[model samples]
Target: MRVLITAATFRSHLYPLVPLAWALRAAGHDVRIAVQPSLVGDVTAAGLPAVEVGRGPDFMSELKKSIDSDGGTPPGTAPSIDKIVVPHIRIAEAVVADLVPFAKNWKPDLVVADPAAFAAPAIAKAAGVPLVLHTWGPMPDQLWADLTSERTARENWPKDLVAFLDTWNVELGPDYADLVVDPCPEELLAIRMAKRQEARYVPYNGAGVTPDWLDEPKRRPRVCITWGTTSEFMGPEVLRPPLLAIEALAGLDVEIVAALGKAGRELLGDAGEQVRVVDWMPLSMLMPTCDALISQGGPGTVLAALVNGVPQLVVPQISAQPLGAELLTNSGAGLTLRPDELTAESVVATVTELLDGDSVRPAARELAERNAARPDPTQLVATLADLAAGR
Candidate 1:
């Protein structure tokens, strides 16, 4: 079987799909990834065939600009309902245009797509292929409301964006998906919402496949801190506080490994004796050793921490981060602190609180165990294959 996997231009979007693509290939299916032209190298590196979609822009630059323009809120900061609804439509429309031909030409038996890359489902409909929508993040209520209001023309988005996304609604409304894989656990979603779709409970994407670096034993309690690669651009300024805060916690018999991207690594100076800074490290590997995680609350990071059974402290930079932090707080697995309000004392206090409390540890352990018990990727791929075969 030939499978075409589509994802948004961003790395966070692309990485989750890689493991699944590899799994398909291992099962003797022909697998190809349609993504931004710049990410062809990453796709090829993972041994998946690459198909270019968009004329690539510097993703980090675009993200930084968006974060700057959007005014990244500190942790625990919530976005106004309006901001979430409008901008995403514009971004998705632009992304969808690039992806259409890629999907049409590949004409795979199945198309697996990130939620943001709504174009894949549309193309699959047009090409008479099965579609699977892969959602690795929160399904925003604002987005649902926007889609629901399509008929009445009620939306918070600008006229241009609304017009663009509406085109897909008109083009592929009924023939959308055969299946939807919500990589997030059911505990994350308020309720299932898709019609004629099965929502599978898969663990966070790109999580828990151990890397080669973590086999070494360590003396101190290890703590993993990373604000996804997007944070490098969106919340570069937000990076300083976490680094500084960690320095203060150096005395607590803890060892810190901070995964900052290129920009973050440069900005964060030497991380001293107990703390180390690296340009990048696999979260799947680092999370298991870490006792606690400090993050910018991106969906991937939050889910990675949850799947690894590591307690977290979220400093929400933007998007659905505040919501994630809220969920963490509600679940008794973590705390949320705003960036502006963050101090060395606060970071130390929060880490101390998590360590002292049994709830954070046990809750995280329980959730991790639940996620670990989920059906493996082979089962999911077979289920998707059955959908494609119209079984």
Candidate 2:
């Protein structure tokens, strides 16, 4: 069987699909990733074959420019349709022109895609293949509603998208896929959903080497602080909160590891000996060694902490994070602080709770058990094959 998976250029967009790609290959089915030209290297780095389709600037780099100009979309809130969703739709229009020709020639049996990849449905339609929708992580219930909202209302679409739809010959719809493979924790996603296939959240931190710090024994409780990649590009001001967190966490006996990539490290030079700041540490490799985490509420980052049984202090920066952070806080697996609520005192208090509070540990353990109980990607191999075979 041949399976073609599609994603946009962003690593956050591409990484969520890696485990499934690995699953398909392990099961002996041929798999290929078709993405914008810039993302071809990332597709190959994950050991998956890549087919480039069309061109676009690095998605996040473009977004960064928008954010810098208009200011961020307020921490904990989703970006408005114009600022966020429309750009993606525009990209899809460009990529599908190239993607459809490849899909026709490759003749894949199944098509899988990240939520942001609007081209997948059209390619599936063109090839007469089953289309699978994969989510990046658990989303806010309201955000989920926005994503799954009314389709087939083509007349209501913005004029530009309407034209794009006509050109692509595919109707505008939320999640235009036959099967939805979702990896959100069930408790975090309580809203009734359609065509939902629950899958485990598996962390893919890119191909990485283990840091030397993991080799040393922990002399104290360890806490990881990370801002994922988007915040790094949003501007230097985004690093302020972590720097504030460092000040708050100082004098505590805890060891701090801020895995803020190279640019983040360069922005924050020498965070003292007690604070080990490094670029490019994988959360899947680092989280198991830590007792707690502080991050800007990215779905992948939050799940990485949860799956490892580590409690967290989440400071939601943008997009779906605010909702996911709220759900995590409600689940008792973690706590959330919105942009307005961030401070040195707040950061210190939350980190203290994660390390010393009794409420968080038991919840964290239970969430970990639930994550482990869910079928991993390797287990989902037969399911994908069955979907392809229409059985």
Overall local distance difference test of candidate 2: 0.79
**In angstroms, how far off is 314's CA in candidate 2?**
0.7
List model 2 lDDT by residue over 1-391, tens digit each. 9999998667887998999999889888999998888788888999999988867545665554555567776653445555665567667877887888888888999999986676787788888888888888875443245335445345444555556556656534454567788888876774534578888889887888876769789999999999888654455577777778877899789999987777678877877888998887778899999999999888888888888999989888766677778889999999988778888888888888889999998999899989888888898888878988999
Task: Give the top-scoring candidate (TM-score).
Answer: 2
Cα deviation at 325, candidate 2, in Å, is 1.2
Instruction: Give the TM-score (vs. native) of candidate 2.
Output: 0.91
**CA lDDT, every prediction?**
0.67, 0.79
For model 1, residues 227-300, the per-residue Cα lDDT tens digits are: 77654334466567667767768868788887777776777667677777877776766776788998888777
User: Which candidate has the highest lDDT of all?
Assistant: 2
Off by over 4 Å in 1: 56-105, 145-162, 165-176, 195-213
Q: Per-candidate TM vs. native? A: 0.83, 0.91
